[model samples]
Target: MDKLRRVLSGQEENEERGLTSQVLDASSLSYSTRVKWFFICFVAGILLSILGTALLFIPGGGFKLFAVFYTLGNLAALGSTCFLMGPLKQLKRMFEPTRLIATIVMLLCFVLTLCAVFWWDKKPLAILFCVLQFLAMTWYSISYIPFARDAVMKCFTTCLS
Candidate 1:
């Protein structure tokens, strides 16, 4: 309870692991670095997700493997979005609102996935939700590409200099 309280209040510290604060501050990293990491994570997530889809085409009992890849990809994408939020929020003026929308879309996808998996009849709705989720993810990724591109250029220039 105490630990939770401290973490919630943003006062937690773990010195042994060399962690200074429990709270994450986006300003701690350079904008370009943040963008680069975001890009890497996003690409990884997309690749994993595509691989998961490919697994779905397998003829026999690939559900488990498909689930594994799908879950991993989703988690990666979600994690990347969250990780970039701090830096993007600080560096970009338009990120906050769009982030909110993306979050909501993901949440809806979650609910729909659960409903579709358990209820059987709602599978169509789940399919629709999946499409919506894909669009949201695509939009979120595309919107942030500029920041990552700028960061790459900055890094390239600095290396040349």
Candidate 2:
């Protein structure tokens, strides 16, 4: 009840953590804090995606497991992408108009794929949607990988140590 009220009121307090976190109001976040969250979320997305992909390749994994992991992976990737796009948009030369359009298209595909997963009754349509989603994901990966490689490498190194 307290948490719900805080969220609705646009102010939050994390008593267990000894923290009082404000809601993401327009004036709340600093530039560095936003950037920190972006990197953190991106790293998490990469880890989830890798784990999910590994599950897909297990020899005896059932369709249900595959779908679960795939959905989780894609959802994470989509979230990270959303975070990154904000900063990426600020780069005038690096992110051209066409690139922004492509990013928007990829976001759309991710959403459609998520919806298709819920429509399991229409197997044919689901398969087609999945295929299209895969293509869009693949295309986005080409651009996203370069940006994420450093973060992923650092995350792995930190985890190993």
Q: Best candidate, TM-score-wise?
A: 1
Q: Could you tell me every candidate's TM-score relative to the true structure?
A: 0.50, 0.44
> Mind giving the per-residue lDDT tens digits that candidate 1 earns over 48-114?
8788778767876444344456656765776665456563453353346746676567656756654
Weakest 10 consecutive residues of candidate 1 by summed lDDT? 17-26
Which regions of candidate 2 are displaced past 4 Å?
1-27, 58-61, 81-105, 111-135, 138-161
Output the TM-score of candidate 2. Answer: 0.44
Cα TM-score of candidate 1: 0.50
lDDT (C-alpha, whole model) for all candidates: 0.63, 0.57
Give per-residue CA lDDT, model 2, range 26-93, as digits (tens): 33556677667777776776676566556656776333344555556665665654454453343442
Q: Which pairs, if any, clash in model 1?
A: none
